[model samples]
Target: MNDKENDSLPVSALQHFIFCPRQCTLIHIEQEWSENVLTARGRLEHDRADSGYREFRRGKRQISGLYIQSEKLKIHGRIDVLELEEINPKGQSNLPSFHLKGTWRVYPVEFKHGQPKENDCDRVQLCAQVLCIEEMLGVEIKQASLFYRRIRRREDVLINQELKDLTRNAIKNLHALFQNRTTPPPINDKRCRACSLKDICMPKRMSVKSVKYRQSLFQPQEPL
Candidate 1:
């Protein structure tokens, strides 16, 4: 498919891709989903952030449920919260916004139900938001934030070269997977235990069966 078609990819797929490719395919490709405690809590968290409101505090403007897109990245999604801060314009003009004036820096903030994970999934997701904002606003975003409900604090993320590269690569992979319409095989790992699709995926059973099949292929036949 052409880049234009791939541009319709969802930004959330990046997080799913990072979490587990199999899970990504199951949901996006197979259209399968099941809600568990964790997912329910996460939905609640997003609902609160997706209320669609704007507030001003401490010289900063906070907007919730901001829809953003990046045709360059071929991804589109709504940001949970976007914080804008006025800054000195470095001899460059900015596009006019109904809510923003002068030179303002954009900072995307994502809300989560739990504390940070061991991987960069959350960070990459936030970075994808930043990329969208940059593309839409024609501004450079150096950082963003992720708010964890359990911790009740925002973890700042730097939009460095490494993160940008990772986010781009993830978008590429997501497009490829979606275009091919292939659902990857299940991987029975620790993350699967928490996955809501565990029952439907049957990763453990499938893994065992695959192992037995491989072993059977290698086994020698006796006199029949």
Candidate 2:
């Protein structure tokens, strides 16, 4: 059920699972990575804040490059941004009074250099973060947001029961893929253009071949 040297999985596992399990295992588990220009740009952007805390802004608190851990979920990862519900409106760093309010929030904001995606990969990744927070805080998180730098907008995501189910399934699937060590076939399209691992992923060639194979099987054996 677990690897002997198993480290806790990253919260981004959902993102990888949605993209391609092979890509996720390759990037995270094996720690193998290559830098394309897009990747490089992303790294440079993160370096701007992933190191330490910044001064509080606009009576609200902000933190960048946070490393969070959840014992229950057995997940760990870096959060790009965390909007701590400012305990003090007057600039003091007091934690929220759970005794009075009964609930508090740790709003996660993932920073992406690109625009919003057509699919739920990013949504799942962001949701994964919320799940980790829930496991850590022992509270039901209702929602979170992802901020796209290119578009300069915050897209809110609801943490409904449906997303929770999908996230759990993704984690199970991810562990299974690692054990099997099989890279799924590629799914070609415009998405390939944005994926830095496209060359290693072979999504386009694999998907084209898949379609061809299916067609041949249905062509009636060319009259034998």
Candidate 3:
């Protein structure tokens, strides 16, 4: 893919990848969505997070939320939360948010369900957000964070080169998924038990098939 296609990635892609590649492809590529209790609860949480815009000051740090987008980044999405340095206090009202002073300073926060996982999925999403911010503000963001609803605490994240690579790779994967237009077979694991797509993915059935295939592979080919 050309640079144009690579950069055409969406910030939400990172989240979908984290949740499940198949689910991500289904939602983004197929434009399909069905809400279960888990999705409903997540939507509610985000709804509460998006309801208002608040910027407060505490010891020289300014906290703001619900920042919509602008001409920068060229991608449309809302950031969960951002911490900006205190500058240009009551300054220019006409200045675009991306041009606001402390433009080089930013902290992106993403809210998630359950606790942290043993994967880089969430970090990848946060890194994508940082990329958006960097492109929009014409600055570099080196770090971000995620807040799990279940944990009710923040885990610091770094948008280092590794994460940047993951973000780029993830975008490529998402593009390939869209091009293929295929839903992946279910991944039967403990994680599947909590996934809302259990009914649709039929992970248990897929797992059984996998087991049977492996068994057959191991079975002796004596008659050959």
Candidate 4:
């Protein structure tokens, strides 16, 4: 995709893409959405995180709802929380290099409704945010975090090369998916049961029914 088009993609879509490409296409490409109990709780969790609040406590500066983007990755989104830990400028440590004048440890924390998953969905999302922050601030972040509402605590994530590679691959696939503009067929698996868009998506029905005919029926065509 071109730079202009890539700029329009959101970082959150990477999580969706990781979870299920069809879900990503439905929400991003088709603009379809629905609310379920799970999604509602997740929204409630994000509401507090996205409040645009800032604070300083115990030698750390906490910034909520910080907007960030990456020209290289071609994704933009708001961070749930950006915690900056003050450090000794001259002290040498294993932390990432601080590009800015001040010495600080940067941490991007993402808020989620559930506990940590086995898949890379949440981690990739967090890593994408890290990449965006790195590009925007010209700094390297060695660690990030995720706050799960279910566990009511924070989990540390190592920003390693593997996670970065996964995130970059996901971004490339996301742009390609958007360029194709074709919604993928649903898998009708356990994930479909939890998805909020299950009703609208009709995964089971669509999987069994004639997708092309349904598309032709719903879409308008020009008269010849």
Q: Pick the candidate with the highest TM-score.
A: 1
Clashes of each: 1, 0, 0, 0
Local accuracy of candidate 3 as per-residue lDDT tens digits, 10-75: 667657766677767667776777788877888888875576566656513333445433233433
- Model 4 scores a TM of 0.86
Candidates by lDDT, descending order: 4, 1, 2, 3
1 against 4, candidate with superior lDDT:
4
Query: Mind giving the per-residue lDDT tens digits that candidate 2 earns over 1-224?
Result: 46532746777765867876657866876676777888798788888568767556654567778777666556678888877664434443234332323223568888887888887888888877787766665556687888888888989988899987887777777767766775555667676777778776677666857857866786776555
lDDT of 4 by residue, 1-224 (tens): 67575466899899999999999999988899999999988898788789998887875878899999887777899999998887865665423542334467888999999999988899999999999998887779999999888989898999999999988998999989988988988878898888999988899888835676777888879988
Residue by residue across 1-224, what tens digits does model 1's lDDT show? 87575558788888998999889988887889999999999998798689998898765788999888888878989999988876754423364764445677778899998999999889988998999998888888898889899889988888999999998998888888888876676779899989999998889876857867866888997969
State each model's C-alpha RMSD to the native.
Answer: 4.1, 6.0, 6.3, 4.6
Pick by lDDT: which candidate is best? 4
Task: List where candidate 4 sits over 4 angstroms from the true fold.
Answer: 1-6, 89-101, 208-224
Error of 1 at 141 (Å): 0.5
Error of 2 at 14 (Å): 2.7
Segments in model 2 whose C-alpha atoms lie over 4 Å from true places: 1-7, 29-31, 57-59, 87-104, 204-224
| C-alpha positional error of residue 124 in candidate 1 after TM-score superposition, expressed in Å | 1.0
